[model samples]
Target: MTFQLAACAEMLWRDRPIDWRASRLKELGFGVGLWNWPAHDIAALERTGATFTIMNGYLQGRLADDEGADMLLKSARETAAVGKRLGVHRLNLHGTGLGDGGIPVWQHDKVTGPMWLKARDTLNRICDLAEELGVTYTLENLNLMEHPGCPFNTTADVLTLVSSVNRPQLRMNLDLYHTQIGEGDVIRWCQKCLPWIGEVQVADNPGRNEPGTGEMNYPAIAKALKAMGYSGPVGLESNAEGDPEVALQAFRNAFTV
Candidate 1:
């Protein structure tokens, strides 16, 4: 069976309008992934009729503090409305809000046991909101190298949190690029995260560009994912090394197993 392929419109065709990018991706026979929703016009995107796979779920919030959790929930509630308007498939969250350059707004080099407990509790609350909103939420893992001092940044940390919560409303946004950077075994991580995975995101390491531009053997990884019975969304959250269409084609070729 073939996987549901998508590409992040925010990452590709940077010079064009966001809705145009979404329309182009749709025209190319792929679903579109977005970042923050507030940056674009909802009606314009809705008119594109692009199948939105996933997008950032919160505008501003953290996961381990009472104030942050409240902020997160409020932000999520507002974003959920936009997501529903666009018919987004999944809403994604991180351990905390990401700032300029993808840095964690609340960075913590050492995550205490209490912080872990709080994070899990916060995720449960997020799940509660998702259940109420008739939508799903995904907690994504970030790479420490790129997002240093980020709590629950590793694939292991994200897995532990999602598994601990163990709710259908909450799932893992298993990003293979971050996994490859933080942990080398991509296929095994895919197997481990397969059960609770809401989506699988990818970009080649060393450059965070299209798959073929780097060392990752995306075709083989795609084959492995198919064998693992993962027929979910495989998204390209990478920048184009050269021509955007060529980059997208390379991404499609890699996962067209």
Candidate 2:
């Protein structure tokens, strides 16, 4: 895969000046990832000459009755509409939590069972809306260490969701840092899920900071990605230690693609 560095808007909007961020990203040849921005801010992003690779679709419990699910879906559609207007394509979504009741059968039980069937139905509905809006929806695997409630924490979880949804546009966003924390074998898991992989986020392990700062062997990871025939952006969704340029340079050296 041709690697592309993408800055997450979360830290940029917090520590750095916004205008400087746009200019820096343009100079560094990086794309952008919109986390949680208002509509007007999204409009402003369109003017920055940066392509949005993916976005936060929704944030709530995964259960059917969660009010946040509906609200997030509405917001996801609106955000995706804005992204389409700006020539962006992928939208990232989180999985449901294991409520006080228990983990859903889809995550903990057989994939062909009734509970999973219901979850697949809900995912299909969401995928249908995403298709109508002309955007690809990618379900992300979160780190259980960071997010204990996240149901889809392993590559198996992601695989099951993709297989159950069984739609061309429904894919998975493989975050390397999360994989390191949540799965026993990251490279093997990537190989197994290659067909369903869509967008990818990369950062070193332990700190979720730039590569070389933490324990992840990014060069091996990049090679593994290429071996799996992944030809997409390796989004830089980590924190910069000193200057953003330092992190950018580290990414360039590590990937060397």
Evaluated with lDDT, which candidate comes out highest?
1
Candidate 1 regions off by >4 Å? none
The true-versus-predicted C-alpha distance at residue 48 of model 1, in Å, is 0.5
- Please give the range of 10 consecutive residues that has the lowest summed lDDT in model 2: 101-110
Span of 10 residues, lowest total lDDT, candidate 1: 238-247
lDDT by candidate, in order shown: 0.93, 0.69
Give the backbone clash total of model 2: 2
RMSD of each: 0.8, 4.3
Q: Give one digit per residue, the lDDT tens place, for model 1 in 1-257.
A: 29899999998889999999999999999999999987799999999999999999999999999999999999999999999999999999999999999999999989999999999999999999999999999999989888989989999999999999999999999999999999989999999989999999999977999988888999999999999999999999988858989988888889888
Instruction: List model 2 lDDT by residue over 1-257, tens digit each.
Output: 26666767555535665545655676777777765445335556667777667776653335333353565567667767666866766777766633333233224322335545555666787788887877788888876666655555567877888877779878888887888888758788888888888877888877778889988888888887876777777778877756767887888787765
Model 2: pairs clashing at backbone N, Cα or C within 3 Å: 1-231, 62-96
Q: For model 1, what is the C-alpha lDDT against the true structure?
A: 0.93
